[model samples]
Target: MSEQWVETTLGEVADWSAGGTPKATNRSFYDGGDVPWAIISDIQNGPLRETAKCITPAGLDAIGGAKKVVPEGAVLVSMYGSVGRSAIARTPMATNQAIARGVVGTQVSPEYLFLWINAHEGQLDQMARGATQRNINKQIITAFPIVLPPAPVQERIVEIIGAVDDHIAALDAEVGALQGVYRAATSLLWGTAEGDEAAPQLLGNVMHLDVVRTPMEAGTTYRLAGVLNAGKGLVDKDEFDGADTEYAAMNILRENQVVMRKLTAWEGPITVVPAGFDGFVASNEFPTFTLADDIAPGWMKHVCRTPRLWAEMQSRVVGTVQRRKRLNPDQLLLVALPVPSRREQEQAAEALDAIEGQVAVIRAEATRLRKARAGLLSGLLDRTIDIESAELEV
Candidate 1:
């Protein structure tokens, strides 16, 4: 550690204050308000521009004199539910009692402080108090230990971390755009005009449920696959114990096969099994399907993801309660689908595949960048990596 570096509490480097909520019974306090009022939900990994709810000046006054408006650049932390979540206020705002505002003083850079708090989230989580819903108080937050460096060094550190974050944000934006394109293409591919001649047929004619259970043997290891809700995709269920004595019957998932979580079919937990996950096992809750030779598995997966199909699946759900609702395979097979010619299906698949491939690459790059940033944060914050040397590279 350099001689110039010092260890200090957050209180020593910034002004500390807590926020409060106005009385809910009074309609005048919140109706047609101008002040942006923040809640714990408003605290994210980045700067907060606006909030879910707003408050009038009378509402602010009702919270009491101490809970004043927090200005832009002030670092705010959630002290109650979702403890340790932090963000910078991009605009003037006031928060509920669950948030603690740290007004950056001349001693420290606001960005540096925000990044440091984010990097040390585990410590904040450890400091939370209570039995039911864990929480931290103003005292705990203000007394939190911080490793301080010179203002110039802090600015350089922020520059290094901020660059990677900006890159990640850009990649995320591109991925979103690509996904929108894919959705639009799918809509075009499935659109039916008044005189369109695409044949409408039952799903059972094009796809069949692959329910052949490959029962687990006594001592053999098997990979488990889980379907993610909301059309996310398949994920390896590493948490499943294949060696458990009470293992149930599981169906084997093959490449290019479509899988759906029966319980969450309404919410769109359907996806095509990509290559390299060929032999994974899935429980009955996740039913697998094999498409006919004429149908493209990718296109079928997208069809299942559509809100129209999801509504049909919801109608087929059979259960007494909402959570218990499950889609019956027989009923699922009876759902209608518009069948296009083989040539058109292949062309649509190719277009969607191109967009999806680009999205996958960008997402993988984002993951790598996040890991690299985490490593840099740890090394720089702990003084394991020389700030001056890192600054030169940046």
Candidate 2:
């Protein structure tokens, strides 16, 4: 530790309090309200600018003295559910009982405190107390130990961290904009309008389900993969290592084949398998399909991800409740699909492929930036790297 730094409890450097929730049965408390009411879900490891729910002045009064509206710049930590998640309030807002607000004094910066709490998230989780659902209280938060650097040093640390985060945010926004353009272009090319001349074709005519199974070889290692909802693409399913018994009868996924989670077809968990993911294994829950000569692989994947197709697939679900609902291969093959000429489908696929390639590049860059930021944060907070050096690097 640096000789200039002092060790102190969070309570000595900040004022701490918790929040509350109003009665949900009261409609007047929420109807047409403009106030931003933050919940545990609203804390996104960054500044809180908006929330999923809002409440009126009456709602604020309903919580009584137990909850208080925190001003802008106050740091908030999730005390329950997702414990240790923290964010700074960008605007005046009220939080639910699960969030703890820390109003730092002149000796500490809110951003620094947020980063500190984030760095010690595992410890915070351990400190939580409960049998069913673990939770931390105001006392635990206030009494938490923290290394206190001078206010100037704290501000410098924030500046270094914020610069990298700002770059990441810009890349995220760009990815979103590119995705929007791709979605609009796909809709225009694939959507059937009233005046369209092309006849709609059954999906079975353009694609056939691939039910090929490859039993896992004993002592052989395989890369397992799964599809993500909302066209997020494939993710390695290494977390299911113990479920190798389940993979014994898993189907083999080939390059350019479209795969979908039958149970989550309504939620759009479908995508085309890239060549990099070829030879991966997926369970029966994920059904793979091969495109016909007339259809483009990329275009077909986008079609399966569209909301219109998802709604149609949902209609084919054959169970009483959501958890039990499933989309069978027979049901999927019968869905109607808009079929444009091969040339038109190719052009649309090309455009979407370009957009997706750009998104992939941005995501890769963001991952690198995050790694660098994590290294820098650890060094700076632990006093292994001096503030002057970090400032110069920034």
Candidate 3:
């Protein structure tokens, strides 16, 4: 520990509070209403903003004045399940009792504090000492302390790190726009044959063609995870057995097949089952299907990962659980897929591959900058660099 490093409780510099849920019995409380309800899981990046489910004002009040609400930019620390993850509320929101709301004191800045808690999430876990669920209470937080720098120094330090975050957010938006450009380009190249100038043949009609694609063990395996990695198309096969594994019904694998994640947990993930995962079998929740060989596996992978097809899956899903939606296999088959000639698909894949490369670089840079920002905060709050030592031009 440095001379500036001080071991103390968090209770002294912040107001620590927990949240509760509204009565589930009251149906009138929930229904596409305006008030955004934040669950502990919703605090992924920071303080909660938008939520998957909305509750009415009545719903807000039903939980016994639980509406104290987490403020936009407030520090939120998870105390259950994914313990010790900390984030600053990005927007105004509310959370359940599983997260502790920390309002920092003048000696600390929320941005700096957010990074501090995140960088030291494991340390915060120490305060949570229970057996079943490690819970961090108000007393634990207020009493938990880290060495702090003078307020001016803290502000300067936060400013330095905040600039990096601003850039990362901008890059993310740019990558999203580029994807739209890619879709438009691909559709024009492969979508429809104009006016049937030449006979457009049905895929099933031409079964004996040499160019048709396939998966390793097509329909037999249940996919649990490892399907999609955003622009990465399909996540390369890796075992995902977190909850517990080894199912009796191991779906057989095939080559040139398309695997779609049915459960919302892996929803939106699609992959062209590669040969490397020749016999890989997934969980029952994932539904697998075959794509005809006439369609290029690479091109099909591009189209399936696009927003157009993914959004269509919403109406076909059914359930109320958080990971609720189940993709309709039959509904998926009927959907018109743009098929390109083997030669044309090869060209399209080349273009998509390039764009994906660009996105990957941007994404890697973003990750690096974010981690760098975290390191800066660790040094800032730890007081290795004093306020007087940091000279700011502005």
**Runs off by more than 4 Å, candidate 3:** 1-8, 17-42, 45-56, 69-74, 78-81, 84-108, 129-134, 183-186, 192-270, 275-294, 306-336, 383-394
Clashing pairs in 2: none
For residues 90-109, could you state the per-residue lDDT of candidate 2 as single tens digits?
A: 32324322222333322367
Rank the models by TM-score, top first.
1, 2, 3
lDDT of 1 by residue, 239-264 (tens): 44556736667888888888888885
Task: lDDT for model 3, please.
Answer: 0.55
User: TM-score of each candidate?
Assistant: 0.80, 0.79, 0.65
Better of 2 and 3 by TM-score: 2
State, as a TM-score between 0 and 1, how close model 3 is to the true structure.
Answer: 0.65
Which tens-of-lDDT digit does each residue in 339-380 have in candidate 3? 556767777777887887887888898888777666665666
In candidate 3, position 55 carries an lDDT of 57
Model 3, residue 354: distance off in Å is: 2.4
lDDT of all predictions? 0.71, 0.72, 0.55
Top-down lDDT ranking: 2, 1, 3
